[model samples]
Target: MSSIDIQHPHTLAPAKARKAVEEVAKKLAERFDVEYGWVGDTLNFSRSGVDGKIALQPNQLHVSAQLGFLLGALKGPIESEIRRVLEERFK
Candidate 1:
């Protein structure tokens, strides 16, 4: 398995940050078939070959994921896309 762990800082308030996360999650659901829900301030998600969580804080978002064997090989692009999305949404 391959793992991705990113800590992204943001200036948004908690409520706004949560809303941004929800928007990201909705796009992920539609584009990647990911299923997710929030538990406290953390948003947990999973799909066929991936499992992850995005933990929201007042000024930061911690994204962590574990990729299965096949997808692990494509980790670079996947991580890049995630970073792109986070950058676009949070900045």
Candidate 2:
């Protein structure tokens, strides 16, 4: 298995950040077949070949995902896309 972990800084208020993440989650669901929901300030998400959590903090967003064998092969691109989206959203 491979791992995709990313931490990003943000400037939005908690509520705005939550909204931004939820929107990103929806987009991810469409592309990656992921399911996600909030548990306190964290968003937990998963699919058949992937599981992850997005931890929303006072000044940062921490994302961690574990990919099963098949999906693991695409880790590089996946991580890149994640970083791209995060950069776009947090800007």
Candidate 3:
């Protein structure tokens, strides 16, 4: 299994960050076949082909993802979609 970590720093407050995280998680869950949960300050998820953590901070957001499928199979598209959604929601 390979992994990719994508981080985005936001200028929002903690409350906004939390909301953005939840929104992103819900969208990702609905769009992809993944299981996600909030544990403390981090949101974790795993599907048959992918696993990752979405860590939220007051001024920063970190997304650490692991793709278990082939190198170029599912990683690029999923990562792109995740990035787009995060940017759209958090900005």
TM-score of each: 0.96, 0.95, 0.83
Residue pair clashes in candidate 3? none
> How much does candidate 3 score in TM-score?
0.83
**What C-alpha lDDT values do all the predictions have?**
0.95, 0.93, 0.79
Winner on lDDT (2 vs 3): 2
lDDT by residue for model 3 (1-91), tens: 7777888878888878887788767876897766889899998988777778988877778998778756437777767987887787776
Q: For residues 1-91, what per-residue lDDT tens digits would candidate 1 score against the true structure?
A: 9999999999988999999999999999999899999999999999999999999976889999999999999999999999998898887
Local lDDT at 73 for model 2 = 96
Q: If the candidates were sorted by their lDDT against the true structure, best first, what order would they fall in?
A: 1, 2, 3
lDDT by residue (7-81, candidate 2, tens digit) is: 899999999999999999998899878899999999999999999999999989999999999989989998998
Question: Candidate 3 at 9: error in angstroms?
Answer: 1.0
Off by over 4 Å in 2: none
Number of the top lDDT candidate = 1
lDDT comparing candidate 1 with the true structure: 0.95
Off by over 4 Å in 1: none
